[model samples]
Structures are given as structure tokens and as C-alpha cells.
Target: MMQRLRILTSHAAVNLMAAACFSALAALAVWGPGWVWAFVPLGVGAQMLNEYNLHRFVFHLLPPRAQWAFDLLYRAHYGHHDFPTNEKLFFVPVWVAVPMLLFNFGALWAILAALGVADAVWIAVAIVPVGGVLAFLGYEWFHMTSHLPVRKTRVERYVTTLHNQHHFRDFTKWFHVSPGGAVIDRAMGTAIDRETLKTRQRSEFIRTLGLRPDDPRLVSARRRFATRYGLTEGEIARAAAH
Candidate 1:
């Protein structure tokens, strides 16, 4: 009922829509020959590099000092970190995904135009967007399974276990969502040690925004949303007391 509708409106749905649209565009990119498609994988390498940069540089720039930035992090991410088991927070919200797409695609357009490669830019605009869509779709699926309950094949089970270690064990380590995606972290020297993230603190601006992680309002909202889909959290942690 409402839950299904909610999922459709969620950010994961945006990824699905964007992927389908770009895939169709790539298929019908009549301006180029069949050979142009062969070179698209090269663009994927660039997209993967962008993904690594986003996770490392932008995402980790959390605990903001400004209210606007804090709210942005709240909607885009960080909320997921607070309640990893909540399916509602697992996907990218619409607010976050739209601007990110504009920036990535716009930057690509600008760079291509700057290089003075008119025909080449058109080809890139087509193929590169498709690659980015597919990559993000794969990542969204992987991230969802890591948080929400679903039967996993042996390989899925293995990789998701690796990813969940980031949530339950050490947030500082294992930023890569794809299986064996840690290669990027290793190469970039961002692979952190265990529990290193817990040593850090949230920004004061977060308190000012009054949208602190896992607040009752946030939790309750998620519960209502997940309950509609029969996707309530499977486990809860109890604080220790004397």
C-alpha cells in the first residue's frame, strides 16, 4: 500500500529511473557508430574514480559546522549511519540525488566543451551517463541489501557481510560497497583502521539544527515507513547500565 508507494518515491527509485533513461539514450545514440559503444567502459573507470572521491572527500566531510550543510548531510547520508537497519534511510533521498546528478553531468559537459571536442563530447555525454547510471544502480542495490533483509546468494552474502562490518564493527574502515571494491581505498590510502571513526565527534552545528542522528522523530518516522512494508529492524541494541 503506502509502503510500496514510499519505496517508489525513494532515492533508489531515482537511480532506477535514471539508469533506464540513460541506457535507452545510449542504445539510440545514432550520432555515433557501433564502435563508439566499445569505448564506454573507459568512462566507467572515470566514474568509479568519482565515486571513490565522493565517498572519501564529500561524505566523510560530515559533522558540519553550518546548519545548511548539516541538514544536507542529514538528508543525503549520516542518518543511515545512525540507524543502519532502517530500510527507509538506506536509499539516497531525492534532494541529494538531483543536485549530485546535475553536478556530475554538468561538470562532464563543461569539461568536454572546454577540451573543444564537439563530437567526442556528445559521445561521452551519452555513454558516460549510462555507465554512471549502471554503476550507481549496482551500488544502490548493494547498499540496500546491506541494510534491509533479503535472501542472499553465497556471493551476495559474502560481500554484504563485508559491507555490514563497516556499519556494525568499524565505520572508518571498508568504505567500498562493491565486492572487492576496497582496492580503491587501498590505492588511495584511505582504508582506515578498525573503530577509528568512533574516536571522532559530531559537529556542534548538528545540535543547532536539532536533527541529531537517530533522534526519536527520525526513528519514529522510519518505523512507520518500514512497518508498512513489513521491514522493521530485525535487531535492536540495548545500552548497558549498572
Candidate 2:
């Protein structure tokens, strides 16, 4: 769809601009080399912390006063949960990205200025949004491409498959940025190991078909579906239902 293509294009453009800004800041800092390394990790870590907070709190909580904002967030996030393979809706639109980037940078700058880091705060604030955008871009791309119809490259195939499993089998786990499947999910006890996900998928499938695990018809269907898909009957059923 043209609308979907426009969204993707906008996302890609924002990502490029964010990357350029981040690189420029890094390059600027390099002139004062000693402090550059120190700042880089601090900025990146801060951004990661922000990512976790936004994902766990803002996106999931959906506080009442910000109904309009929540509606947009839900569309960008929960909507993805509702239709994981819908590539058109996968990326964060510029409407979301632009506001978030400006707000974060502005807020961080204000905080740093208040804390007496005004001179160097620009560098830090600049890096924060850039880092955030880069992370978001990577997340969007990997997630959208993962659901593409064609088979992917080796690494893409692995990550895409893993993420697909997370969506269809275990939505609670594997909440990290795509491709790497970061330890954050494991640390949070949200990482669904492959086998565990397979089991969950099967269980969900059985539940969806209005069949119990011990039902003969359910068992028969599971077996048939499993044989055809090279998965357990439960997995096949779950995949189909999803």
C-alpha cells in the first residue's frame, strides 16, 4: 500500500538523520578525545535505560490523561502485538519518532542544565536521541523484515524466526531488540527458550480449538498438522490460529 510505503520511507529517513546527528556528535567529541569515550557509554546506557522504561511503563501502562498519546502508542505498539506479521504497521511513524526525539532531548538538556552540566549537556542530549533513534530504527527494520514473505539471510532468518516464535508462541518473552536477542530478556525472565516456546505454542493451539490436551480429536488433529508442518500438532494448530 502507498500509505505503508510512505510510513516505511519516513521511518528510514528519520533513522538516517538520527544516525547522522549521532555520528556528528561523536566526531565532535573526538576532538576532545579523553572525554569522548567516557561520554559515549554513558549516553548509550542512558538511552538503553530509557528504552526499558518506555517499553515497560509508557507503552504498556497507557495512563488515562494521555488518551490521545496512548491511542497512538497502542497503535504503534499493541497494534503490533495484535497483528505481528503486518509489515505495513510495523515501523514507528515520524509522528511518533519526531515528538519522542525532541521531547527526550529537551528534557535531558533541561535536566543536565539544572545539574550544572550545561556546557557539555548538549553533547549528551544530542547523543541520547540519536542513540534512541538508532535503536528504534534497528528494532523497526528487523521486526518488519522478519515478517516479510521471503526467506531471509542466515542471521535475518534466525532472528526473524525467533521473533515470529515470540509473537505466535510466547508474547511475554523475547522483548529485546531483534537479531541479537539480548540478555535483557533473560535477565527479566522474559526470554522464551525455543523448546519452551514450542510447548507454549502447542498449548495455546489446543486451547484455541476448544479442545483439551487429552481430547482424542485434538490429539488427532495435532498429529496431522505436526506431520505436515514438521512441528507438533499443537504448534501447527497454534500457528494456524495465530
Q: What are the runs in model 1 whose C-alpha is more than 4 Å off? A: 1-20, 23-29, 192-242
> What are the TM-scores, per candidate, against the unseen true structure?
0.69, 0.63
Which candidate achieves the best TM-score against the true structure?
Answer: 1
| CA lDDT scores, all candidates in order | 0.57, 0.55
Q: lDDT by residue for model 2 over 85-159, one digit each (tens)?
A: 545446655566667776777777787778887355545544565455555655665666676765557877777
Segments in model 2 whose C-alpha atoms lie over 4 Å from true places: 1-7, 10-34, 61-74, 179-181, 202-242
**Against the true structure, candidate 2 has what lDDT?**
0.55
Tell me, by lDDT, which candidate is best: 1
lDDT of 1 by residue, 94-142 (tens): 6655566667667777887788965565555554566665566566666
Clashing pairs in 1: none
Instruction: Give the lowest summed-lDDT range of ten residues in model 2.
Output: 205-214
